[model samples]
Target: MIIPILYTFYLSFFDWNLIAPTKEFVGLKNYIEVFTDPVNQKVILNTLIYIIFLVILNFVIPYFISLIVKFFISKMQGTYKVLFFIPSLFSLVVGAMIFTWILNPVSGPLAYILKAIGLTMPNWSNSGILAITVICLITNWKVFGYNFILLLTGLGSIPKNIIDAARIDGIPKWRLVWNVILPMNRGIAIYVLILTIVQGLQYVFTPINVITTGGPYYGSSNVIYQTYLNAFVLYKTGTSSALAITTFLIFLILLFLEIKFVESRDKDYV
Candidate 1:
């Protein structure tokens, strides 16, 4: 893995073509070209946008949703837990397909409501930016239930006695959660943050492939999509390899930041 990764990084320094049967060692030229190219610039910006939405949807929204689920589940029992987890069982393909049908302008229930209300429902899959945002939304909806399960486990790890003591001390609900519950579950918080970032990046490929295919003027095409287009569509091996290396580096940097954040939070836990 390291060899291939390193080789790609090395290849990024060259202007090589697979068809020409010639390899040109153009150090930093490819990297410079990638930065200067308008299409490449758009791809990079779109990728960063995707990452921002992915982190917020996959981490922040799910975290809050899980908290809500756990809070409600405290008074409920087994059946509710199973019901809440139903979405977790759904595959991404299935979820995306379901949402696509539901978003259909002519026949979907949502569209019908919008039409009744004298409003327009845009064709999300056809619009590049809209498609990308919808992809993130679907990803959030699909994975939220599983995130809830993870958070439920974290919530369960907290000792009930401490919470009861806080309640008895006349602490407000938010204060109890912030001061008592969150501090105790710092490990869980960090674990969730790291896992969410990793998972969000990993799954970004699915929506781009399934829904947009980097269409509607490359609006939804992220770095992964651009790499795929270069390697598979255009058969530009060197360029794709360069893109892969840059993407890996960017991913590593993001991962490192998350690791540092986790480490900083861990100090409180200790």
Candidate 2:
């Protein structure tokens, strides 16, 4: 793990094709190019957009849905769990392909249904926002369910005594959940939050590969996907390495913040 990452970092300062016997050192030029390249800039922006969408669809939505299912739903919670989780059982490839067929602006069922109402489906593939949204939708189908289950487990893990005491004191359901449940659930909540950001930004890789190939001009690509494009498709090893290292540092910072936040919260959590 460490070796490849270190090698990639070392390789970032040089220009090398994977096949080349000679590495030409061009210290920090690749990193400079990555920052200045219009495509890389867009890809980075797209990744940030992906994070925002994923946080909403996969993180915030699932957290609340888990809360609702766990607390409010009084019956057949098992069935709901199974229904939500079934999508996660399939691979992203399957989900992407399924959505591809379902959402195809031409000749897709959605298009056909819209046509029946004298309406036309917008060409999502031609637009950046819609393309990314489609990718997010495909990813959300799989991720939302998994996050829901994980969060549901966290909510379940809350000490029953705390909940019981809150209830005995005639705490309103909303107040009990807001004042008591949310704080204790933070441990798992933050884990899911970070996982959501990680998966939220990265999980669209398969859908993007299949649906857009990061097109209408890299409209749907994230950092991970862009790195793969540079390394394998473009065969620019140095640039890819720079991208890899840049992404690593960014995520490393996120991991550090998560640890610090959790540690401080644990101390303050009672």
All candidates: CA RMSD in angstroms? Answer: 2.8, 1.9
Candidate 2 lDDT tens digits, 31-111: 998889999999989988998888889989888888888888847877878999899999999998888898888989999
RMSD of 1: 2.8
| Worst 10 contiguous positions by lDDT, candidate 1 | 71-80
Candidate 2's TM-score reads 0.94
Candidate 1 achieves a global lDDT of 0.75
What's each prediction's TM-score? Answer: 0.85, 0.94
Deviation in Å, model 2, residue 96 alpha carbon: 0.9
- Alpha-carbon shift of residue 247 in model 2 (angstroms): 0.9
Q: What is the C-alpha lDDT of each candidate?
A: 0.75, 0.88
Compared with the true structure, the alpha-carbon lDDT of candidate 2 equals 0.88
What lDDT is reached at residue 108 by model 2?
97
